[model samples]
Target chain A: DVKVTQSSRYLVKRTGEKVFLECVQDMDHENMFWYRQDPGLGLRLIYFSYDVKMKEKGDIPEGYSVSREKKERFSLILESASTNQTSMYLCASSSPPGQGSSYNEQFFGPGTRLTVL
Target chain B: LAKTTQPISMDSYEGQEVNITCSHNNIATNDYITWYQQFPSQGPRFIIQGYKTKVTNEVASLFIPADRKSSTLSLPRVSLSDTAVYYCLASSSGGYQKVTFGTGTKLQVIP
Candidate 1:
């Protein structure tokens, strides 16, 4: 079974503080993603990395950044945490789409609910 | 990017069949529609996927029309455990194709 783990299930940070959320997947998948889910906004993509050190900005990448230095690990960074940034952060990993498959299924870790005060 | 949209919520009784619909008007030719179920405090899990026509698995069924502008997920005889947020995703196989998600339909099952 594939396993993805997040560093913390719940986190509290003060305003203007720099925060880091770590994610590691054991399946050695090539694609990793970070998304923030809000009550009415659903899950909006923040950043996705298709390969080591390669990253792309998603629709709502304004207040967040990501790093993927190792194949099994991806990290989401909040440069300066703010109260508005409080939300549930999710990490997911998946292999590249296989032949005859349009979209590869993503395996997600238990989300980290971050509260910025 | 193919943006998918679903209703905010739905309600049903136990043992009743439930159907949730999603729209993806801008779906690309190569894109396929997939559904995911997310329980409270848990990450989403894959439910089903299909390009066109109809496809069925033990858990649910997916129905897509020829135009592929929309799709529906059908759950048979749902139980209380089936209550969840169902998300619709229309995506393709590019190494970096953006996967767009909408505010899934929250299904509540009553006894």
Candidate 2:
């Protein structure tokens, strides 16, 4: 089974504080993603990494950065956390497409609800 | 990336079958339709995926026609715990393809 685990289930930070959200996957998937879920707005992609040291910006990437130093780990960094950044953050990993009928099947962690005060 | 559109919300009774349709009129030839279910405070889980025709699993069935313009997710004998938001997105074939998830349909199961 593919297991994706997050570093925290909940977090609180003050404004302008630096925050880090860690994610790890056991299946050695090549693709990792970070997304933020907000009420009414739905889930918006923040960043994604296709391989080690390779990252791409998603729909909403402002004030956020990502690191993929190894295949099993992906980290999301908040440069200056603000109250508006409070939301549920999700981490997911997946194999490249065309692997089988499970093409692009993303395995997700439980998610971390971050609160910025 | 193909933009997907589905109903905002749906309601079903316990033990009844529920079908939610998602439209991807601009779906590309290499794009695959995937469905995900997410509960409150939890991350979205992959429910089912299909390229074309029909695909069925223990949890749900995905039906896609020849044109591949739309797809329907059929949840059989839904229970109270089946209530969640179902998201449908078209993912292209490749490792670097971008996936965009829309707001998705919120299913409410009533006993």
Candidate 3:
């Protein structure tokens, strides 16, 4: 079974402070993604990486950035946190593109709820 | 990415089959249909998907007919634990594809 794990399950930080959320997948998947879930709005993609050191912006990537220094780990960074940024952050991973069914199925971590005060 | 539309919520009883439908009117030819189930306070999990016709897995079934204007997810003998938000995802194939999740159908299974 593939497992995607997040570093923090819950976090609280003051405004203007920098925050980092990490995700690691054991399956050696090539695709990793970060998303934020808000009420009524549903899950919005923040960033995604198809390979190590390669990243792309999703629909909502203004305040967030991502890093993929390794194949099994992906990291999301908030340069300056704010109150409105308080929401659940989710990390996901999938098999490499061109691999079977990777375009659809992505394994997810439990989620990290970050509250930017 | 095709925009999907689904019911806001649904009600069903135990031992009953629940069919939650999602509509994607402008689905592209190469796009594959996917559904995900998300419990409160957790990340969404993959359920079932299909291009056309019926595709059934142990967790649920996906039925997509010709023309692919819509699809239905059938959950048999739903239990209380089965209650969650089911999201219909459609991703366009060819080139760099982007996936957008719908509002999702909130299925509340009752005993």
TM-score per candidate, in order? Answer: 0.95, 0.97, 0.95
Residue pair clashes in candidate 3: none
Ranking the candidates on DockQ from highest down gives 2, 1, 3
Best DockQ goes to which candidate?
2
User: In candidate 2, how many Å is residue A84 off?
Assistant: 0.7
Worst 10 residues of 2 chain A by lDDT: A97-106
Q: What TM-score, to 2 decimals, does candidate 3 have?
A: 0.95
Candidate 2 ranges beyond 4 A from true positions: none
Tens digit of lDDT per residue, candidate 2, span A11-92?
9999999999999999978999999998887889999999999999999999999999999999999999999999999999
lDDT of 1 by residue, A5-95 (tens): 9999999999999999999999878989999999988888899999999999988888888898899999999999999999999999888
Q: Estimate, for each residue in B5-46, the C-alpha lDDT of model 3 and write its tens digit.
A: 999999999999999988999999988889999998888999
- Give the runs in model 1 whose Cα sits over 4 Å from its true position: A99-102
lDDT of 3 at A78: 94
Give the per-residue lDDT of model 1 (tens digit) for B59-97.
999999999999999999999999999999976765548
Per-model clash counts, in order, read: 0, 0, 0
Put down candidate 2 lDDT per residue, B1-111, tens digits, no spaces. Answer: 789999999999999999999999999888889999999888899899898899999999999999999999999999999999999998777555878887899999999
Residue B76 CA displacement from its true place in model 2, Å: 1.1
